[model samples]
Target: MTGRLWGLGVGPGDPELVTLKAYRILRDADVVAWFAATGRESNARRAVAVHLRPGQEELPLIYPVTTETLPAEVSYEGLLAKFYDEAAASIGALLDDGRDVAVLCEGDPLFYGSYMYLHNRLAAYYDHEVVPGVPSMLAGAAVLGTPLVSLNEMLTVLSGVLPADELYRRLVSADAVVIMKLGRNLAKVRDCVERAGLLARAWYVERATMEAQRVLPLADADAARAPYFSLVVIPSATAPGR
Candidate 1:
């Protein structure tokens, strides 16, 4: 009697940024799921709080990104694999009872979202839907007043953890670059942009629409110290020869 599960993108940090369609989906969903690592706050769930009514069930999936401290026995990926399997089993339990679940996603569901993991696990046995929301890169671009791309300009979105060689090559070829998860990788990323002669055009923004947002020209920020939510954008060079 229940309908399919929906993975809804709640947009960036600001609750106001949530899309109307995503809202309609969450407003009616019987169960809502979100992810949060140990000792951290659940911003994704907070982004959709207004839509949830009293007594509605909310589930939190504890997903911790493995760092080197973890032993090789269970391995980081192995542990995560277990978590995903368990999460799928739990969701499936609810689905078996005909309860439609809506999982909350920050930014777009497919763009570096955790919802994909849940979707992939349950898609085979359950009906599903994904509602796209505004991406942080686009929101960061707007906050900084930078045009993301124009005619014939390539746009590359890089995570903070990409290998140095791959990051350098892409920086050189792309007309515009938006590097997400700038956090601890800011120094390395900034250095690459500088070496590639794109430093003058680099800009960074953190938390996009949230009150604590930070926006800086790469030249002004002490790249080595930017926050985790920050990202950098490199616009096309104006002088072809310079």
Candidate 2:
């Protein structure tokens, strides 16, 4: 019989934020897998490192590229597709051997987590389960002491990868907004927020719920020094102090 595959959301940056189910699953899992940039430690794994027991096989799926511009002949999407295919095959082989694999995710599994790649590839052929965890946006809001939304207010979550004009359009119309993936795209995001006349109201948060957390106005953020773990929040008119 094939062993089950589990996608465990370890929560954003904070080990304490992990759920009871996730802790148990990590401790008992035969194999623990996490994504990381090449030559860097895995944040997902680090979140639950304390729960990982001795003899548990740790798999670091090192990404080939992160934040760097792709060469003309190599497309970023193509590279990611190939990487996911290989990762899925490796995990599938372990499952076929009756070894349960738990893939650790930084936030909620289906909420833009890298675990979705494996899920999409293996779910059709194997039994799988997803355990949810607290996402960074919620944690960031808590740390910033700001409300994400008010009564009847719409909250829009956007990726900094969006086109400048498109981001500007959405920012102007949205009641509240959270911009994520703000590493190299911080300048672009800042421009869009400025164009929408929301720069002063924007708050920037880095590594929320973690030891190295930072919360400040977007105007004070340095685009050149921003890290990938940062987020920008724009409160709605109905929000307190707004």
- Each model's TM-score, in the order given? 0.92, 0.96
Candidate 1 per-residue lDDT over residues 1-242, each given as its tens digit: 54478889999878889988988888888888888877676778877776688888888888767333675665787788889999988888888889888888889999989889888998877889999998888888888765667777778888867877778888887788889876667788888888778888888788888779988788777856667568887766542321
lDDT of 2 by residue, 1-242 (tens): 99899999988888999999999989989999999998898988889887789778988898988878877999999999999999999999999999999999998998999999999999999989999999988887888786879888899999998999999989999998999998888988998999999987899999998889989999989658578788998888666753
lDDT score at residue 31, model 1, on the 0-100 scale: 88
Top model number, lDDT: 2
Any runs in candidate 2 off by more than 4 Å, and if so which? Answer: none
Q: Can you list the residue pairs that collide in candidate 1?
A: none
In model 1, how large is the Cα lDDT of residue 184? 68
Instruction: For candidate 2, give the lDDT.
Output: 0.90
